[model samples]
Target chain A: MLLDLLNKLVSARYPLRPPGAVKEDAFLQKCIRCRRCEEACPYDSIKMAHGDWGLKMGTPFIYPTAVPCYLCSDWPCINACPTGALEAVGEKENVKMGEAAIDETTCFAYNGIICRACYERCPIYTVAITLKEELYPVVHKEHCVGCGICEQVCPTDPKSIVVFSAHR
Target chain B: MTRFELHFYKHLNRYRRLIQILSVLFIFIVPLLNKAGMHAIIGTFYSVSIGQLDIVDPALVLQNLLLTKEIHFPLLLAGIIPLVITLFFGKVFCSWICPFNLLAEFADKLRKKIRPKTIRAKNQNAKPQYYWLVFGSIISVAAVSGIPVITLTSMPGLISGQVADLIFYGAVGMELSIVLLILLLEVFFWPRFWCKYACPVGAVLALLRGKNTLAIQYDAHICANNCPVNLKKVSLCNAACPLQLNPRQKGIYPYCYNCGACIEACFNKGGKSIWFTFHPQETKTNKSGS
Candidate 1:
């Protein structure tokens, strides 16, 4: 119980950048902390990254739970960035901030309780998340853009299904 | 209007306060104003833009330069603009526009009212940490992965961005809790703790202004001649200083933001001895008396 609590507390749940974030090193160098990306995000998903991340402080990021990106068709964040820190990647599928992975031990469907929360809410639907026996969810790494809708919609407390930030 | 009727410093103080309030308002409105069709005004304290023009924080830019080992153009411009402003203005940003100072002023007022008279006396033990923080950040950034860690302690930039975040994005982070904790500290323990001593940004502004001549000038001859008895008493200018600085002292230039409160106090006390000027004055007078 204590370990579970600690895991929830200290988990590496770093916020994912908007649709068109460059690699971490380039992003840090390129971003002027203009906050244009945050402002352009229609869903209010983007927020300025504060001190906790050290040097990336005042840069833009999106916490999925607070407000997940609605994945607008035009991608306003990329367009708003004047510094090219966030490039205009062509498609929603092309912009991979991170990938959603399931912890089967805590997932209700895996525990025979029958839940398809992640599979139902995933942006890519059948491709990103698919149902096993038409019930338990299985995440396909290639199809998942890590928009974080699945994690946001996850019914399980401590989120059985969570999106881990993409390793640049 | 006649020179006597004009109330020069009073109007200046009012203007400074107006700018400070406007800056705070600008941060609050940034997200609202920045939209798809109306991409007119955007950014927070770290950076800001009006149309195509942009202003970036020099300290953050310098940190990025140290870390990345490559010079970026826009960020360099952002960093240089503030440094240039600090060059002519001499830490006027702290007095006229820092959003954190507005919050601190309110907190300081509450502190003054709530705390007893005995404890309200400015503690003499408080040492200025701005220099150490500035240098320490540089050393640490070089040693620890080249990323500037100074922003972690930068109250103005951090809080302004966070408050904007909380209002526009409906998001709050650990920094809010940290700010609240500091606010609590400001109210009870030490007044003007962060601004007077700790802020790295303020340290950078002070260093940039290094003996640059623009400062609160103390006319000792005038004070010595008129109201010499009042000069022996606790100075109104010293009491008016939010940073607990003696405006009459020559050494106060480096730390004096030219906030004009001291001048206001002097005016209130029926003396116009203290005033802002760009002329270099004698440093010897600072050692003479309180």
Candidate 2:
């Protein structure tokens, strides 16, 4: 019965939940659908998913293009959660919401252009992203928290550096 | 037989509307405070915790119970405040506090005044929507597996929170549409449809009220004979009720929000027939003394 619900939730195009969201299955069960996280989000990064489907209703999620998590030091979204759907992580680097991957086809830095926008805007610049000697941007997946700031600041029309949600 | 105290009824009526307006105003103010970095002073639609004390919606508590399959003691205790209040007072939240009800009431009046010909849906024998409780719990179990379902339909929280987000951020996301649709539908289809038949929160509150201990008691003698002038005129108490419930009927006690509107109407019309009181025995003596 539970697996049936899980399959239904995953079948849809799932957006990334907040930074400290628990594993998807646990998050589904624990979230009371109170939407306090949406209220607490400072940047208005969190928006409740709206669909008529009974399974996807009133859940908090984020679309990077609209607003990306600012990664506040206090982590208000997690603190505001009454249920432990979102848990506090020991370090911001450990708050693994997703992974950022660079699309070589669209990346200006990769196309021999002098663009280091992603690296420059990276919240965890030195650790998660770095610039090579030729000024090419490289994303270190291991250290990336995937807060999506780099994606938001990407100069490409559609971001060359996109954060793939770890949730799915 | 009893006489309604006009002054006391007037005072209660004034405060009831005052509380309702304040609660609705605070709905907008809370999100702004949240934006200003005040973490301690926020409560969601499901639960409201101020400082240390918490008061949760009992319907949501039931959902948690279905999902977790065990009692979360802190949440249970948090829910007790509203439950205990409901047990004693009977559905006061619907009339005097819930922001959605206040808006719906205003919408109802506007519809009546602006488009008097609009045919409002009427369910004369409306019963508490128990199916919502069953469906809500089933959704909670599914949510436990994957999917947060109830927040989509929790009108009070969704509307107020979305309104707050709109004011603070100047962004109206798709979530606001559901609430807007309900309000728009209300202008034509049903006046107070959600609260009257479908609100799970109202259903839970009605269930929590074990007996009609604190409710409006009708004095038939006074209503029929004490004030001939009131009887000659149209029934103000009946017309004043936003829910369109008859306060003069003992059967309607469970649905009465103790909003004091009927009491005010009765007092104003020199009827003094319908009065809200706790002890039936005490009100008789108290009314005679007054």
Candidate 3:
């Protein structure tokens, strides 16, 4: 449908939305681009999409490499939303921002370089990321909330582990 | 009596300027307060929360309702304050509170300074309908696209949003350029053409007016007999209007934001020809009855 195409065009970047963000199409419809969530963020994780985002401009997104969501006990961003664009998730662990993926070819651990940075920095720790034979860190995708702490703390240049937006 | 009227009229613009400055400052202050660990007040012009009271732009609310095809009580509740304000005040937000209007006023001043003798072509007759057309098209585009496309063109929202971005992120976004481009156009080519013809926010607010809405009322008897500017090519009030509207005309209501600029101009010229009336039509009826 025309609506579907327009939605896809606007949200083409599929930027990592804040925690408890509804589906992309619904979020675009509901979000008035107020930036309350961006200001409400204690960790400065939420950022408004700029003009480069076209129609998605002013909508909240997170560039985890610069400042990853700290995954606060209470989602203040969701609470601050005037519209329900960012919905409330009952439990913090239940928050699904996106899913984290590790590129094995470029990973330091895969290249025989000792790196446990992502595992140590993961908010969920052993649940989201675990060491394989006490050497390689393997991401447990289901447990990963995609807070991007691993992507932020990753030692690799291109980010050995990255969180792909779940909405995409 | 004349001196008192002049003093009172002069203060309207002064008060309007003060409010405009404060609204601009409020945009920055809210973010600073939030950064300083006070969440009591937050947000931009698109939506703002002062303590427990939330005020969302009614245009945004309408667009959201259309796009999502859902009834959201909280969102509707947030939009009521602005809706009610527009109903009574008749687009006063466009003149008084909108930071873009304040900026456009400066642009108008600069345009006059740069080209002092240039006579602006008046197209007042065609503007209100054009503005409504623009508003209608934007709403239709929003409904079809299933996106709140109006937000991109909402000047006050963009200005306040960019200001918040600057304070929070220590840098402004590319949206600031859109505002600058419009301002550039205002300075070089058209003066306040955006607000007069294309601002969907102001258009929606202007459309909310009824007979009882606060509006400019012209007293023809005062103007015809006593006004100093009557002999001049253009009356003081008509010349003073930023939107180039003839204040003496009967149908300037929809385009006029009740800014009192024309009223102030009339008072400055020692004429009591124009003033604001809460119930314009009713006041006329009462005068005839008496």
Specify the highest-TM-score model's number. 3
Local lDDT at B140 for model 3: 90
Candidate ranking (lDDT, best to worst): 3, 2, 1
Q: Where in model 1 is the C-alpha error above 4 Å?
A: A1-11, A22-34, A47-59, A63-96, A99-164, B1-6, B34-37, B116-148, B169-171, B210-213, B286-288
lDDT of 2 by residue, A1-168 (tens): 564455465555556889888776666666766767887777889887654434555678887877888888988788777766788886788888888899999999888788977788778868899887848888898899888888888889888989888876
lDDT by residue (tens digit), candidate 3, B236-285: 77677888777665557567788899788777777886877776752231
**Angstrom error at residue A146, model 2:** 1.7
lDDT of 1 by residue, A86-155 (tens): 7778878787988889999999999989777778777787988998788888999988898988888888
Tens-place lDDT digits, model 1, residues B1-290: 25753487656667777898898888777755653335677666766766767677776666666655666576576566788888877888887888888888888888878985623333132333545664666546543543345555566767776766776647877776767788889888877777766666777677786455467777877776674346554667777788777767655645567788878777766676777666756634634446
Error of 2 at A117 (Å): 4.6
Every model: Cα RMSD to truth = 6.0, 5.2, 3.5
True contacts kept of 3: 0.81
**Per-residue lDDT tens digits of candidate 2, residues B1-290?**
32335566867767887998888777777777877877576666666667657667887776666665756576688788988888888889888888888888888887798788853322232333443455556465545553334444677777776666577668665776777677778877777667765666776677765544577777766777776453433556666777766555434544556787878887776676777667653223222211
Please report the candidate that would top lDDT against the real structure.
3
lDDT of 3 at B64: 80
For model 1, state the Cα shift of residue A28 in Å: 6.4
- On DockQ, the leading prediction is 3
